[model samples]
Target: MHFAIVGAGFTGAVLANELAKAGHNVTVYEIRPHVAGNCYSERDEKTGILLHKYGPHIFHTDNEEVWNYVNQFTDFMPYVNRVKTTSQGNVYSLPINLLTINQYFGKTLSPKEANDFIKSLADGEIDEPQTFEEQAMKFVGKDLYEAFFKGYTLKQWGRSPKELPASILKRLPVRFNYDDNYFNHKYQGMPKNGYTPIVERLLDHANITLHLNTPFSSENKVSVDHVFYTGPIDAWFNYNAGRLGYRTLDFVREDHEGDYQGCAVMNYADEKVPYTRISEHKHFSPWEEQERTVIFKEYSRKCEEGDIPYYPIRLVNEKTMLNAYIGKAKKEKNVSFMGRLGTYRYLDMDVTIAEALDASRKTLDCVNKNKPIPVFFVNPL
Candidate 1:
């Protein structure tokens, strides 16, 4: 069977590779000139540092299957994302560890003592936290919330914490121990060469044909047995239902000698600060040495037409529109919507790859059984 996969990101690339391996003709269309989408990385001309063109993407996951899958393509270097944040004119470890708590409060407390202290600071009145602010206040208390989360959340989402859902804050951890590793995943590392090579290898199959700088719109008719779309769901229908809200990012690149922030990622948790985080690209690839460094000061804002959407602002209004698009997507024949943009959710790299793998398996099963292909392998809603 002939299959069409949209966007040459991990989603499309994985699907194309799987289908091609099954002896099916697979054609991938990537609007961008690059293959890895947001995960695209290249060496800087001057600094010779591998720059994450979109932003720093640290691959961390507890999924052993995903770890083994990615390993087949490129060698991964031993790298743990130890993030730092600058808040209230001070540098502190991220995930609100014991060191951060002690430093912020000017007290050297034990793990048990710190846990009790934080609990005391938490607002007991709020029985069930609904909003992001309430969740933070209930978990880490008002002081830490204001100092660490409030300003950064506002800058990242361009909205007050009160307006956002509590689920957003649920992802953030507040630890009593001094473990500052950003993720609790078993496997955490960056590709030795960069993500682009992994994707290139994924697409390098006999039956797979990759088309760069080719945009696939719903209007464009293709002669394929099935279509796997990884683009925005609303875009597939030309925003007939309404455009789903999204937050886009703008990176301001700067070159410097030696280390810039002395860290891979240094987030600014002050509202006064314009950019949310400054990522030193050279630090991302620590296996290689470089005298010069390149940094990107990332700015977040409302996504507009032609802007590369990063985070899906899945507020109440956007959810309604998303459901409308999902309904329309289900009604279409011979098309499957997958990936972060198609599903309209903020997904981690591991989750995206896992989902793509699952989708490919399901697609093959449906074909072998002579069953109709599903509009969605994973429920978007």
Candidate 2:
């Protein structure tokens, strides 16, 4: 069977590779000139430092299958993401570890002592928290919430914490121990070269054809047995239902003589600060050495037309519109919606690849059994 893949990101690339390996003709369309989508990385002309064009993406996953799958393409260097945040005019470790707690409160407390102290600070009145503010207050109390989360959340989402859901805060961890590793995944590292090469290898199958700078739309006519779309769901239907809300990012790049922030990522948790975080690209790949460095200051705002969508704002309004699009997608024939944008969810790199692999397996099974392909392999909601 012939397969048409929209967008050359990880999802489309993985699907194309799998189908091609099955002796099916696969064609991939990428609107961007480059592959890998947001994970695209390249070396700076002057500094010779590898820069993540969109933002820093650390490959961290507890899934052993995902770790082994990506390893087949490129060598991964040993790298753990240790993030820092500047809040209240002081630098502190992120994830609100024991060190941050002690430094902020001016007390050297043991793990047990710190846990009890934080519990005392937490508001006991809120039995069941609904909003982000309530969740933070119930978890770490008002002091830490205001100093660490409030200002930064407002800047990143462009909305007050009270307006957001508690589920957003649930993803962030507050550890009593001094472990500052950003993620708790078993496997964590960056590609030895860059993500682009890994994706290039994924699409290098003999039966796969890649078309860069080619946009896919419902209007375009294609002679494929099936279509796998990884673009925004609303875009597939031309936003007939309504546009789903998303927060887009703006990156401001700057060059420096030596190390910039002395870290891969340093987030600014102060509302007064214009940018949320500063990422020093050279620091990302510690295996390589460079005299010069490059940094990108990140700012977030409401996504507009033609802007690349980063985080999906799955508020009440967006959920309603997303359901409508999902309905339309299900009614379509010979089409499957996959990936973060298609499903309208914030997906990690590992989850994205895992889902793609599962979708490919399901597709192959359906084809072999002479059954109809599923519109969605996994539930979006």
Roughly what TM-score does model 2 have, to 2 decimal places? 0.99
- lDDT for residue 136 in candidate 1, whole number 0-100: 90
lDDT of each: 0.92, 0.93
Give me the displacement of residue 224 in model 2, in angstroms: 0.6
- Per-residue C-alpha lDDT of model 2 across residues 338-366, encoded as one tens digit per residue: 99999999999999999999999999999
Instruction: Please provide, for model 1 over 1-381, each residue's C-alpha lDDT reduced to its tens digit, 9 standing for 90 to 100.
Output: 999999999999988999999999998999999899999998777777888999989999999999999999999999999999999899999989999999999999999999999999999998889999999998888899999999999999999999999988775598999999998999999999999999999999989998899998655445888899999999999899989999999999888888889999999999999999999988888889999888899999999999999999888999899889988998998999999998998899999999999989999999999999899888787
Question: TM-score for every candidate vs. truth?
Answer: 0.98, 0.99
Candidate 2 wrongly placed segments (more than 4 Å): 218-221
Q: Which stretches of candidate 1 lie over 4 Å from their true place?
A: 217-220
CA RMSD of each candidate after superposition: 1.0, 0.9
Candidate 2 least-lDDT 10 residues = 216-225
Q: Quantify how close model 2 is to the true structure by its C-alpha RMSD in Å.
A: 0.9
